[model samples]
Target: MDTNVITPEGYAELQQELDTLWRHERPEVTRKVQWAASLGDRSENADYQYNKKRLREIDRRVRFLRNRLSKLRVVEYNPVQEGKAYFGAWVTLVDEDDQTLTFRIVGPDEIYGKQHYVSVHAPVVKACLGKAEGDEVRVRTPDSVKLWEIAEIRYGLAAADR
Candidate 1:
């Protein structure tokens, strides 16, 4: 498997999530599981079944987080990677239709449309790497390859100023 590269921001986010899962979520679910187990006939109890499934899910996530955290290498902010796109570059691109999309290239764990984070291994991010501003790149997808131009590329997390 390709080693996942994580930025400091991504690592911190994962730590926060792990902390929440362990300190808050786990305890709450454990209480529910206990309450469900106390009820008679666990095999037939709906609460027991639901809670058991939830506990299994939580445990799985916990294991994933632990393993991911252990393997990740947190990237520190460096000024040298400014001009060229790299794994943690925050890039802004414009599609053929002139639609603009802004995203940060991080690791797999940090990716989601809502988070504006794309995995470094993603096709689009991979295409954008080493590409400077005003460069046109063809991003290959399972459906069809789309063309996009690098309108802008900026680093630093959070807002542009931050």
Candidate 2:
């Protein structure tokens, strides 16, 4: 099962998408479908067929977003999480070669379509949890063990500075 937790910002983003699709795009597409259907002979009318298909897709996405929003639990940043890796943290890691990688640890649902956002369940994330800056994490990949050091950890609005 996908994790039910989401950062406050991630929750707002999902809510905004739902609002745009439902209140704006859905109405616009519905109008197109109605106008096309009025032309009659839907089987032969390309506009009608295409709009009908688009409407179904919109409806399916709306249903999913609504259900997901209802079930998600927003996780806000806490002062206690300072100086440690945790959910909603922006972590910068340095490998043995001094190659650096940066990403935010978020829920599985929130990671979709986002750049540099890793799922909380990801192996690298699991290995880094509770680790402080300068601590080494041995992440076990399918190929081999990779060592990474925590270069930095930032949370909440501080993360936006990057």
Candidate 3:
């Protein structure tokens, strides 16, 4: 398995989700499944079937989380990363059309549900890595190559600034 890279905040979030699933959700679903099974006929027991499926899904997720968490390396902000686009850096870009876009470079595990988070493995991030503010970056997409200028780079203070 590939090493899972994650930000400190993202790691904490995943840990919290795992805890919730293990301590609360899984137990609750298991209880429901047991109660439904006690009603005797499971062939047509909707509650039992539903809860059983839910339990399996929960267990699968728990297993995945456990394995993933073990492999995850939480990335902390480094002072040396200042003034350049690196992992965990908040970068603002301007296109040739003067359109502004801002996003933070984070690991794949952190990008879900966050529109402003870009995966570190993305082509745009690959282009932005080691680039300082005012540097031009080119990202090759399936259709065309996109050009952007790094307008700003900030680390550690991104949340406060936003």
State which candidate has the highest TM-score: 2
lDDT winner between candidates 2 and 3: 2
Model 1, range 36-124, lDDT digits (tens) per residue?
88977899988889988888988898899999899988877688887778878888899978899888888777774436788888788
Order of the predicted models by TM-score, top scorer first: 2, 3, 1
Q: Over the stretch 1-162, how does candidate 2's per-residue lDDT look in tens digits? A: 348999888898899999999999999999999999999888999998998899899899999999999999998899999999999999999999999999999998888787889999999999999999999999998999999999999986443434
Alpha-carbon RMSD to native, per candidate: 3.0, 1.8, 2.1
Worst 10 residues of 2 by lDDT: 153-162
In angstroms, give how far residue 101 of model 3 lies from its true place. 1.5
Model 3 has a clash total of: 0
Global lDDT of each candidate? 0.83, 0.91, 0.90
Compute the lDDT of residue 11 as modeled in candidate 1. Answer: 88
lDDT of 3: 0.90
Our tally of clashes for model 1 stands at 0
Candidate ordering by lDDT (highest first): 2, 3, 1
